[model samples]
Target: MDFAFLFIDWLGKPLWMWLAFISIVIALLVFDLGILHRDNREIEVRESLALSSMYIGLGLAFGVWVWWQLGPESGMNYLTGFVVEKTLALDNVFVIALIFSFFAVPRKYQHRVLFWGILGVIVLRAIMIGLGTTLVSQFSWVLYIFAAFLVITGIKMLWIGDKEPEIGNNPLINFMRRRFNVTDEHHGQDFFVKKPHPATGKLVWFMTPLFMALVMVEIADVIFAVDSVPAIFAITTDPFIVYTSNIFAILGLRALYFALAAMIHRFKYLKPALAIVLIFIGSKIFIADLLGLEKFPAALSLGVTFAIIASGVIWSLIKTRGSQEAHSNGG
Candidate 1:
């Protein structure tokens, strides 16, 4: 086989680059499932933190590799997208916890749902990014629409505060419960089990609560992607960069979820900072137009985004410190 073909370009990137990323992702997944977690078991906070650190390290390392291959601008764009996606996923963590709680999924089975949910996300995000890439390529003006949407979303997030979704009354969940035979209790780690049907009086497969949690998690991912995909597009329109950054961020999120779920209150102020970040990204286009500049600096965008998120986390910790202390004392 000619190695020359591997060096050829696809979507403005060498084919090998794409292959390398896929190879890394596969290896990581294999290590995660086949090696590190060969058995289905409950993940404790300490173990979760360690896994999270490793995934985070791999993500940052990928950014460095991109810097070496793609140049500084692309590198900074990847970093920015990674940071934004990772933080935005904090809200996702909250929802996932709620889904698990609503379904009464045990801690032992939560990882199973999350792992399978990530698989769905990988496919779903690819389709969304591909569609986005095609749209942006055909109509450059769509960026403005995305920008406007982000600004509005950010403002709404700030104004509304954080209102948790009422997962118990979700129409989809209700429809599923009514339409299908669902077990009232979890059946170990299985998503489906053979049980006697109520109407048929025969053995048939019944959906378990674990499956419902997985479906909810997948739906939540699609919803969050609406905000996250546009947010990354504002940073860079390159499909390869956008897609890779997104996948890396999401890959680490499962691990991050375990760590964050235990202490989510500490980052209460991060949402406002995220809102500000969105507004800044949305307005950069207009700001550049006003200044007669071609584009806003990627480095500066990354810097400002880091600063905003950092400040929010630090401030939240400080503000919530006394309350946390009081709760601990009461406990």
Candidate 2:
């Protein structure tokens, strides 16, 4: 076998580097599904936290390795991208919760939906990142477009504040219901079931509510990616760093969803903080141009990003501390 091709550069990184990253992801997925969660059960907050922590630790360790091998600049870029992507994905958790709730999906079946949804996300993000890298490499000015878009998005977030999506009125869901044979109730962990058609009395494949929830979850991620893909590209244009950091961050976030969804209302203030982060990230290019620097400092970006996200989390925890109790007590 001619393995020399592995040494060839694909997207500003050795082909093997991409392969190694893919291999790691596959192993993680296998271990996650084949071992850790082979059985369908409700993932408790404690278990979710532990799984999320392990994924986060592994992601951070990967950044350290990138730093050691690729240089501090690339390492810092990965960390920044990872942090930004993960923070942005918090909003995604809320949407997923809404989807599951609207569908009335069983807690035990939610993980299955999320697991498959993550698989779809991996593929979808790769395509988006690849297209983004191509655009940026061909036209350097596209970064500015992404920057401007991010700035506008951030401003919109600030102005609009947090609004729950009207999942019930979603056109896609309505279209799917009209076009496909969908079951009104869940069928355990199965996404599809063979059932007799109501009109024909013939066996047909019908999608369960579980499947509907999964589709909605995947669509929600794609919607969020519109903001996230550009945000990460604004950080660095390296496809390897952009894609790896994205997948890792998402993997951890999905694991954390079980816990976050239960307490999402407590983090009411995170949206504004995220808005600030986006504005800061988007403006970095223009700020650098104004200051006559080649680019924004990676270390400074990382530091500022961490500080903003940390402050938002702390502020949220403090402000919403008793809201949960109030709601529980019907106060």
Candidate 3:
């Protein structure tokens, strides 16, 4: 009983309704990509733009559904979660780009792996969000736990998040390499690539494109989760909103990855923006108890966060331009 209280959302929802909704979304994804998109070999620039537009439209349509069904507050929460999660998700793009460069993953097949990996992220985050909401709702003190984690992460980010990523070697990955007979060369058009040996007459060496990419994706997702999971608490503690918003953001990540891969680093100020977001949300939680401001609303938090992020982006662009101009003049 205590475990149930601690881990599960006691709020009862209908079984049939859950199945119907999940099935409908899954069916739509299959229809769009499998049926309508199966003939396409590569996603082109115009296609990426169209997909991005479709993604935004899809999210807006979901927001409209929320507003109609739940009311304005729910819709606001969804939007806030969407913005914060989406912006933070961009950092993951930069890391994945670095990883691809490190592993020398070719351009064409990149989208396929990212598309599948991001889908996995959406599903996994849904479970985590559900469990988190249930915990926060029941214990309330988990809010403090998230707060403490954010403050620590914020201080660390401020101190070192700006450092350029070093992807030379990870011990965990090295260990995996030693254990498995990795192919000397990439086996293409395959996520679960495997091969047999003539000498041994068995599976000698094997790997999928997703193999290395999934590790990178998982690590990136976890790092972002440190900020994103806590930040959503600022929007609303309802697990439903957090999960739904996260899914919407992640579903667009493949398109976002292709669209922004080349220019992500130009926003040199993104680290600072994320740092501030973490600190602000952490401080928001810390003060709730001391100031007795549990009535803190998600709407105000969303607006304030949006403003902070916008300012950071504009500043970064201006700085990047100035630096480029200086370099051009041989300064």
The number of the candidate with the highest TM-score is 1
Error of 1 at 112 (Å): 0.6
Cα-based TM-score, every candidate: 0.97, 0.97, 0.85
The TM-score between candidate 2 and the true structure equals 0.97
Tell me the RMSD of model 2 versus the true structure: 1.5
Clashes of each: 0, 0, 0
- Local error of candidate 2 at residue 144 (angstroms): 0.8
Error of 2 at 20 (Å): 1.5
Query: Of the candidates shown, which would achieve the greatest lDDT relative to the real structure?
Result: 2
Q: Give the worst 10-residue stretch by lDDT in candidate 2.
A: 322-331
Evaluation by TM-score, superior candidate among 1 and 2: 1
lDDT of 3 by residue, 82-193 (tens): 8778788777888888878877777777776676677778666876777787888789888888888877887888899668677767765676667765554666656555
Q: What lDDT score goes with residue 215 in model 1?
A: 93
The residue-by-residue lDDT of candidate 2 on 107-179, one tens digit each, is 9888899999999999999999999999999999999999999999999999999877899999999999999
Per-model CA lDDT versus the true structure: 0.91, 0.93, 0.72
> Which scores better on lDDT, 1 or 2?
2
